[model samples]
Target: MQYQAVVRKFGPAAEAVEIERAALPVLRRDQVRVRLLARSINPSDIITISGAYAGRTTLPFIPGFEAFGVVEACGEDVYGLAPGTRVLPVRGAGGWQEYKHTDPSWCLRVPDGLSDFEAATSYVNPMTAWLMLHKKIGLRPGMRIAVNAAASSIGSILIGLANAVGVEPVAIVRSEESRARLSGSLEAVIVDRADSDLATGLAGRHGLDAVLDCVGGAHASILAAALKPGGHFVHYGLLSGQSIPPSFWSSHPDIAFSFFHLREWVHSEAMENVQRAYAEVAAQIAAKIIATEVREVFPLEKIRLALQSTLPFRTGGKVLLA
Candidate 1:
């Protein structure tokens, strides 16, 4: 038997979820059964839980987007992957349950040295940061990139990756306090949004090569203004709850826009490419080239409280359900 947090109806994720129990189903020849150890609550998880993706989502869905677990059992055909291996299970309702059954193709093996929380939280932020930097922007040494929401987990990751390769990063945060949270050693330009002329000032600087933004709406427009002609603007998250202004388009036609949805990318990308990407991200984490943070870990039974801790606009570190 397994316990899971189920969403029978969409509304508020915390209020809508109810704990339920079910027995394990028959395992197929290519499937593996993972004993879930931890799951991370992300904005994407909250969006999926709120019926934002109801058209594609099934009812009574499990809401975890990423989780870390141990391979408890594997079917006869699932060779090379043995029992007791730790992993990040994928390709199902998700990992809010006591166990997850997945085919081997999309599941990622957790490398040594990462805690359960780091592996559980790795897929969303770390992978997205890696893809946007590598595949989308093709970032290289000496390029200038601006990151909005610079205090965030993924934001920190982008800065670290940039620092590692000699690319210059411009970090934009909503306040001076948030700016203080960043390390002075990273050799990046730090901007506090409270300064009224800041956005225009960024536009006038030597000019940015790209902007990696998760905060959409008017703020996205502000960030885009800072990009030089033909600069790439990647929009990934919508924390503002408002759409990017039409003025954003009418105002800056030379700036290219891309919306990055991690789930969609994973579903369509070749499994081999997915594995290779995960391997790169895992190596980055293992070597401390980047870091993942967990502010708290709650037991699986505390589903409601854990969801509340991850609500929008409030930030510190990731919260996990175990």
Candidate 2:
């Protein structure tokens, strides 16, 4: 049978992506074939297409971060899932195609009443937000948490989750434009590009519990300075250059720093716990607590356009390839 794929070509903006006919992937005894319904374009997918993520991908490989699809065929040993079940794969690559072959252990069943779009955007961002708040930070009611990039997909969910746990989230955005885009859902504090002024604004701050930092250049150090004594900082993404000042650690002896990769954490957790986390995300979707904004939807024919448009500062919501 024929399937659709987004093919990538690296050149001077000459057909960077193209929709091509491909054969359906075969399902192994430990795998299942998924008929994709929707897939979201994340920043990671952008880097992959730009040739910056070549280390993690082979040439001409399918590129996608997260997607929701229906199971077309299940392997003999796949018991928890069956044909027609809506599911999402665990990892961040190769969900952009029309059909995908994935290990049964990596698939999470989508709960009833959740739309394909919601499920498509569920696995990466929301799960990261939930894990950072509940597991790594151990934020409790009345505690204060700080999140950089608070207007992005993960940042949006962070605000919602913090509010649910009664933790006050101080949202940090890079520009005045970003600061203006946030809703009045949480207590937001905007950060300017000038470190001198930004540091002055946050000086003498105490009782700051945790910092969820995505930018890792000079910005991480600024965030480190804002933390209270004995506070924790979770470094997940390096949107900025991946280096930080040495003085950050030396100056703050009471503060701690650690990195978190959701893929590593998911693989370590039990299967039952992963299933429970999927259910929780579905519930949050149904309740409108966690919402994904789809900036645009591209059909198979427009895969090239879809891939090119997912760059930073160009789109506001998640870009989906359907």
Candidate 3:
């Protein structure tokens, strides 16, 4: 049997080649066959294709991290999950396809009321936001935090999460355009880079207790300066194509800096721990406290277009492949 997929060939400048009939494998005893409904194209997906994920990406692989699907079939050992159950497959790289064969343990049941797009993108951004807020910083109500790339999917999730818990979220945007787009919907202090320095803007209002920085480079330095003494700065993404400067670390000797990656957390934690976190995030999604907005949905064959739409900037929502 065969299925359609977006295959990334080995080497640089390699486009995501579309394969109409890639060979499909038979299910193993602990596995289930999922008919994928929708999947999101995230920044990590692009980084994996560019061969820049610290050599973690292997060649000739299908490029996707999380996706929503229906259980079409299950192995003999796969109990509880029956056919037609909507599921979100985590911990795999072949989500940009029509079907996926993965361990039943890696799939989470999509909570009711979530659209295919929302369910598809539930894992990566939401899990990152939740863990960073709760586990890393232990952010409390009334605490102030600054988030770079505040218009991004994960940044928006952070804002919503902070708001739900009564934390004051200061969203630092790169331009007035981004500020305008976010101000109407998000309940936070939106600071446009064109109008104010990040440190100056943040200092005038309140001292930052923590910083969630997805955009690295000069923006990270500015965010670092804004943090109060003994505050933490968590760096998760390198959207600016530059890492944190060494001088900033030397200058801000009192601030704590940490790097976060979801893969590392998943690999190190027990299965039960991972499942519990997912369950909590799922509940939040169902409650509408954590949500994913879909900017667009393209069919599996149109993955090229979908990937293009999410390039190098925040689109205010996720771009999905269905």
Candidate 4:
């Protein structure tokens, strides 16, 4: 049997991606075959397709980090997971397809009550936000943290997590339009980049304990400057297409700056630990303490259109393929 998928040829153009059909490989003894129901387009997907991560990504690859699916078949050696179980595949690639054959160890059972949209888009942004808050920074209640890209899915989740624990979240957005979209709807102090300088607006005002920054380049410097003395500055995204300047670190010696990637964290942990983390995140999603707001859902055939939608500065929410 065969399934359709979005394939990325070796190149940097949107045209590099094409829809094609391929035979489904047989499952290995420790593997399971999944019928993918939903997947989301993330910034990392765009970056990988654009050749930014070319050194790491092989050509003619499928470019998706996470997806939700149902167990269609399991190898004889596979246990615990059975046919018809709702699961999310937590792998490095090959998610933009109708079916996936992967190790059962990489699959996490989706918690009951999460919609396909919630389960499909669950791993990357939510886990990044949750781990960064709980494991990396050890954010505590009553502490104030400033988060850039406040309207993004991860940013929204960070706000929710911070609020749930009594932490004060200050959302930094690029424009008033973004500020308006996020204000009142989320519990946080919203700052518009166009109206005021981020450092001046946040530094002396809030006594910020940390800056959870997804926007790199110049914005990262501003966010770093906004951090209170001895605060942590965590950079997780390079949406600006530029890396943080090395000079910023020397200039801000009192602040600690670190880069975060979810893959590294997952790789360092045992499989059982990974599964536990997924279950914890699923519980948060079920409780609505952390959630994804999808901007659009497109069929797998319209992958080009879906990829193009993410090119805009801010489309307000996640774009999913179903």
Candidate 5:
């Protein structure tokens, strides 16, 4: 069968992406054939298109991070999965396509009561939020935690999860608009760019217990300093493309630093652990606690414009290939 997908070509402007027709992959033993419904644009997806993510994908690759689909066919050995079952197959780049054949081991049963959009977006961001808080840091109730880029998808999930567990979240955003947008979820919102008096923002307040940082640049040190002694700092992303400043270690000798990569979590955690994470994420999606907030949806034919329009710094929410 012919299928549609976005493909990246190599050149001086190698970052350019294009949509094309391709043959649907055939199913193999231990694999399932999926007809993709929707896929969300992620920062890692953009970096791969720009040829920076891992620098490992050969030229002319498909570009997608996550997708939700219906199983059209399954290998003989696969159990508990069959035709017409909705599932989310964990794959690297090919999820943007119309159909794919992936290992059945990677397909997680999506909650039946969720929309395609919600199922698609829930796997990555929500799972990351769950793993970071519950597994990576082991945050307890009544502890004070902070998050950078509070308006981001994962950051919002962190806030919701923290509040659900009775933990106070100190959300930091670079713009006033972000603070306004996220005002409902966070206990305290600070404008990172305008406020140099960050200590004053936490006045008459207890010390921070942890911090979830995505903008790993000069601000890493600033965020680290705000933490109480023995507080944990987890760095996940480097949207600013800046290295961690040296001062973070020198100025905060007592604060502990840790890195939380979703990729690493997926690889290191046992299959049961991963399944539990996905289950919690699926439940949140069903409850609308973790909603799929799509800023824009682009057809396969408009792949180039979609990528350009939703570059990380410009997009407000997750962009999807619909």
Candidate 6:
């Protein structure tokens, strides 16, 4: 009984998503058939399903970005990959499906050291955190950086990865509760969401060399001003359902501004470079330098409940579909 969580129309994610029974995809000459063991529900997936990227997104598609599975079958030309070999269909089109067919090139062999849950979430946030720091910003030891929505899985990963390399990362969170969740964990700044004085907060602590922001709109606006001259400001997510003012680019002429979309990097980068990143991230995960915490796991049939638990950054961990 093959199953997939499909979105036929754009709307709110929890309501628009539907589980449909379908036949397994036929293996192509250069492909392998993998039975997906686990998938993760990310904010990016939620918005994409709701038509956030409607311009590029094709409807009537399965909505999932990360998952891990085991090779169950191979195409006529496929070789070496044996049945029961655990693997991650890295960046597959429809990870929500029970069976995913892909060219062997897209699959990364999952190490036995990683559990199914960990492997299922090995990409996306981890990759985003890695590339943004290492590739995009060229983060070096002792460089000062700040990450907002600092309690998210990605934020936590950024903190750990930065610390591992001797970079100092400041956490900027909203509200006292969010700050409390991270109290004493690191240097944190709590600001009012409506109208934060993040710049002022940074002044006392010393301005940042770079700022990595996921919360857009007002929070991003505030963080933008806090960057040192010639500093980089990278915006990746817009959880606030708003955009930073276009005028900010002109207002901060001395600051470098950019946005990061993992898909763009993966699609354009050479496979060897991308695989090198995979190896590094996997090694860190294996060593417990960074981790993706699972708040709960729901079977494919329970997607609605699982989605409802997509708690705002910080407190609740990632919701997984297993």
Give the winner by lDDT: 1
lDDT pick, better of 3 and 5: 3
lDDT of 4 by residue, 1-322 (tens): 5445555465543577887878777678898999999998887777787787779887778878888999999999999999999998887888888988888888988977899999988899999999988887888977778888887778889888888887757777776677766632333554645525665666565456888988787656677776679888888987667788888878789887788999999888998998899888999999989878888888987887887776653737888889
lDDT string for model 6 (38-133, tens) is 998887787788797899888789988898899998889988777798887876468998899887777777788898999988899998999999
Worst 10 residues of 4 by lDDT: 183-192
lDDT of 2 by residue, 29-131 (tens): 8788888889877766666677776676676777776888999998888887889988887655778678888887788889878888888898888888888
Q: Model 2 residue 7 lDDT? A: 47
lDDT ranking from best candidate downward: 1, 6, 4, 3, 2, 5
- Residue 203 lDDT in model 1? 53
Instruction: Please report the TM-score between candidate 2 and the true structure.
Output: 0.90
Model 5, residue 39: distance off in Å is 0.5
Q: Candidate 1: which stretches are off by over 4 Å?
A: 184-197, 200-203
Off by over 4 Å in 5: 4-15, 194-206
For candidate 6, the clash count comes to 0
| Better model by TM-score: candidate 1 vs candidate 4 | 1
TM-scores of all candidate predictions against the true structure: 0.94, 0.90, 0.91, 0.93, 0.91, 0.93
Error of 3 at 48 (Å): 0.2
Stretches of candidate 6 exceeding 4 Å from the true structure:
183-185, 311-314
> lDDT of each structure?
0.82, 0.77, 0.78, 0.80, 0.76, 0.81
* Cα lDDT for residue 249, candidate 5: 83
Score residue 96 of candidate 3 by CA lDDT.
Answer: 78
TM-score of 1: 0.94
The pairs that clash in candidate 6 are: none
Better of 1 and 3 by TM-score: 1
